[model samples]
Target: MSTNALPPVVDTDTWQKELAALRIREKAATRELDAIAAQRRRLPMVQMPDYVLEGEHGPVRLAEIFGDHPQLIVYHHMWNDGAEWQCGGCTGFTSQFTRLEGLASFDARFVIVTHGPIGEALAYKRKVGNTMTWYSTANSSFGSDVGAPRDGGFAVNVFLRDGDTVYRTWHTDGRGTEQLSYLFGLIDILPYGRQEVWQDSPAGWPQGPTYSRWLDSDAIAAAYGEPN
Candidate 1:
């Protein structure tokens, strides 16, 4: 298949009718998502112990990361000490969430966590140019406790606070973590989509190996510095 085929052309009236049909399905999807969210809110939560982690501000407790907020979300970024570069996927995730101040109004906060020494984690932060709240789970069981064990796997963990106890509310990983990046949702509606090989596109639409271009573009090594 060529890489330049276009979508089928149709009469204006036919296009409008087709669009209207899609709109109906989209609305149904929105309603279903709302229903799922309502269920998510009602799901049971588990009690979490106070885990210490190091951040830009030095050592802090998991509860302190939530501060006075009732809800917290942590992105378990993949950043082992010996890795040459930070995870490009995690880099993309952090890039989308740097300006999450709006969540604070709802008593929610977001942070990124990694299993590494603080120095290595800070270097990765500089490499990716992410200024969001990032921390290290080194010398702590935070990784295993949250199911983002140091051996492998990344996760987005949700937690809630009641009195002085923190509770695990929810978590997701892999494609589920893609929702963290607004770009993923934005590009999903584009004509050619994400341009990755896995997408369903017209015979001639562009496709390529995933993350090759990602690394070529954003994989530069950089001098280490604390993000203010």
Candidate 2:
């Protein structure tokens, strides 16, 4: 079991050079992200009329969730309204919800909205042990109107609802998945490698490309074996 038998790293200094190059790329990426966020901040605001959505406790209105705040940022995670596994990327993002309290202090409410029934969404949250607020679009047009219908997949939609008038501020549908991952500092670990991607994984390793929908219970179990 000698660990030194592996081939010697040719030109060890190359790693330092690679590290420098990566740093430069990282800085450029950060600048680009900042520009995008500036654009996001400039999006138009809207007043959302009070509307009810199903929650774990019972029925609650959008206003109740926001409390006195006028801004609500809903993460339309692609749960497929009861799909076997929650999206993998979403699971990663939701796992970091505890750090979002700063946004809350800024009069912002971050909630995960899905077409999944309230009960179903709660069950998934329980399975993942996520503390973030989970809401169901079961009794509301919020999901569809925000471009996150059951089949619509994952998206991040910012809304400003004064009373009953809901104005769509900004919405991201595609690689917006990148924000949640990057926000949670999970993107930085990519270069370190994902355990699931190990080519020589032990017997029962989750062998597949990681997707956002694997946040669900069944998929998590199937891909990565038993949950911790």
Candidate 3:
């Protein structure tokens, strides 16, 4: 293997000392993230209108998406009208979450919402082997009202349900949504760190345009074969 693009080699004792020093900063960052999450938990929410979204079984109320769960996490997938494929970043990121049974124990449910028609969205979901329940906001203002308008980018949104009422709790997009992506998190810990041009890496480290290496739904489907 080539060491030209790798971190400098050092003595065992020296590496241990450097790793220990970095661990201290890592712990501090972890603690700061805990504090930020504490603040996020205390954030106020806003009541939402009774928006009806299109589902496989017809119109479904926003609150109904929660089912028996009190909390709902929605991934607003970016869509392209009449296109055969969708956003590669959104598709790859979302496809990582194929199973969410663990969230049920916490009284939380995760789902996907998009501006595409319900049929097309579900078709793409199957094509990409995405098992998450998906809904369509194409016929309602839910997409635009929740910061994921038609032709816009992807987003992550949280909602709370009380009886039949729903309230928007939190919304994040861009890099803020990275927390939900295990792919990004795993890549971030690597030496090259995403290998994206925007990242601060060593001079000889490999780099490419953002999302250039991301695979779209069709590519993922082709790689993994058709979903059963």
Ranking by lDDT: 3, 1, 2
Q: Rank all candidate structures by their TM-score, best first, as comma-separated numbers.
A: 3, 1, 2
Give one digit per residue, the lDDT tens place, for model 1 in 84-113: 666767776676665788998999998888
> What does the lDDT read for residue 104 in candidate 1?
84
lDDT of 2 by residue, 102-121 (tens): 88578777888877888888
What TM-score number comes out for model 2? 0.69
> Which residue pairs in candidate 3 collide?
none
lDDT scores in order: 0.80, 0.69, 0.89
Tell me the deviation in Å of residue 50 in model 1: 1.8
* TM-scores, each model vs. reference: 0.90, 0.69, 0.96
Better of 2 and 3 by TM-score: 3
Of 1 and 3, the candidate ahead on TM-score is 3
